[model samples]
Target: MVEEQEKRRSSEDEIDLIELTRSIWAGRLFIAKVTSVFIIIGLIIAFTSPVEYEATCKLLPESQEAQMPSLGGLAGLAGLAGVDLSSMGGSSGVMTPQLYPEIVNSLPFILEVMNDTIYFERQDIHATSFNYFKNIVKPSVMGYILKYTIGLPGLIFSNKPEDIISTKDDLSFYRISKEDWRLIESFKERIILEIDSETGIVEVMVEMPDPYAAAQIAKKIELMVTGAVVEYKTGKSLKNLEFILEAHDESKRKYESVQYQLARSTDRNRNVNSATAQIELKKLEYEFNLAYEVYKGLSSQVEQAKIKLKEETPVFTVLEPVRIPGDKSKPKRAVILIVLMVMGCMIGTIILFCKFILVGKRGRSF
Candidate 1:
């Protein structure tokens, strides 16, 4: 009797599943209509969206410093064996690759970038990146729709067009024009800077309407960022070199003066006052020796400065150079259609569920 009851329960569950399947099938026409409407919307968006070309470049910055064993570690190990090595290895507080993006995004850097000349082949337009970003490119259909719809309030309350373009007396690099500021913001949005933690590799990406422009900008940024980093790294060394050069020059001049004075004194007392002449010669020789030492010391320091300049220089290895993208990077129509279809299915399911529940409740109440 128990086995028969279990079998009956299984059969009943199967019947319920079949009923559910049939109910879902009944809504097939509704689902198809909703899906078709979404597909049409996707088509409109896909065709109307602006085509953006992306340029990509990869970089490997100096990670060798971390890999090289420090002299400090060797010094510490010596201490463990009863020798003092506390002063062996000392590292400077140089900015790491992680802060590279921050440096690039700084005001001065952006201003420099704005001054760069960009030539667009398709448009035959030659202008500064500032103007290229500001006036040449047209907004996509969706971008336009959002401006009048979602962004309407901001536009309505914003500054006048004339004020944004005004350059009467406000030509300071620090205080950029309103239109230029907006362009900078947009330019920032289109640039991608990604650094991998494990590999210490940097990937830069640039996207623009024109393929040539995208690639050109990407290459330009790569060179600019590397140069900025190298300059930062070697700044102290360069200043030190300059100081050494000036000190050496001054020391040499003093040495020359002492030599001339010593010669004049020796010639004047060549045959008279032997004791006074000896004392005077000794004093002049001491002065000459001191100056000579300073000059020689500075000569060594200058060589050391050159070495420091080389050591502090940052190495940026280009693993993947910038390439012009052949295809559009935005307005993925397949994704749009799929998302809309899923949304429609969910709405349809909810409606059918509520209808069935209400009808069943009415039947039971009756």
Candidate 2:
């Protein structure tokens, strides 16, 4: 009977669910303290961060226009020869279009941009092209010597005479043998390239301190790319395409004249009933025809070249121009403040909860 009574008393001593809830409510101060801490830290991060403004433009690489005559002539030739030319139609004569975006980012292209004042003069902190420490050789060498005298280990590596020269005149020394390669690396760092995998539309983005400057740089890049494509497409290549056409016309006239004369000779010999003379005339006609064919092929190639050039001039349909940003992209104050306050509150709550659990555990152990 005594053992049964003791067991009943112990069962009744177990924690009650309602009582625990009352205890937790009594610890409202602990929850309030945790929430306060997180809010303060979040605000600090939001205010101090640097603001970055981005300018972006959309572009589609210029696609080549098919020269209908060239394709027709090739198809005709293939048909007459009883060969299939369907596979050739898919080929662009050049490499795949997929590779062009990377090619645009190549060193040569980067170097061209670097030479522009928009990139070189405005982008960097130094307002002028002259960074005196980089330009004047004497100051640079003296600085290096001074560093060496001061026991600076970095100066020991500066052994070459050119290396000792001021880096300002040509920053390419550190960039490697190629100026273009250096520019490419620098440009890549400053510019962001994004391409839509499905649509194949490209977004060229640049972030700068000034919104206007960012917009200008983006605009300049578009113009440069357009001009480059134009030059590449038209084999008239800085030369007038009209000139090549005129020369091609003259060649055609000369070839046709030779062909016409040979034809006349064969007819005359046949009319005279001279088989031997006819055979000789036939030989001349074959040669003239061969020359005429060569001239025709050359004429076709020149026209195709012109057509290809026209296709290379890339035009961008600007989906969105660079807008003057109203808000700075950095230092998201509200988010930072909220996060910091939440974290602080979490830490405080954890500390209070652990203290409560530890106190309860100690009392039970005692």
- Each prediction's total of clashing residue pairs, residues at least 3 apart in sequence or on different chains, is 0, 10
TM-score of 1: 0.76
Candidate 1, residue 47: CA error in Å?
Answer: 1.4
Give the residue spans of candidate 1 off by over 4 A. Answer: 1-20, 64-91, 160-183, 260-283, 342-351, 354-366
Q: Please write out the lDDT profile of model 2 over residues 98-199, one tens digit for every residue.
A: 554575676656545544444332244432111211232132343355556874664454333333213366454333323323324645666766767676
lDDT of 1: 0.75
TM-score of each: 0.76, 0.51
Q: Please list all clashing residue pairs in model 1, or write none if there are none.
A: none
Clashing pairs in 2: 34-345, 38-340, 38-341, 39-341, 42-336, 42-337, 43-337, 134-168, 233-309, 234-309
Cα displacement (Å) at residue 151, model 1: 1.1
lDDT of 2 at 194: 71
Per-residue alpha-carbon lDDT of model 1 for 13-43, expressed as tens digits?
A: 7865686567768987876777777777777
Lowest lDDT sum, 10 consecutive residues, model 1, at 82-91
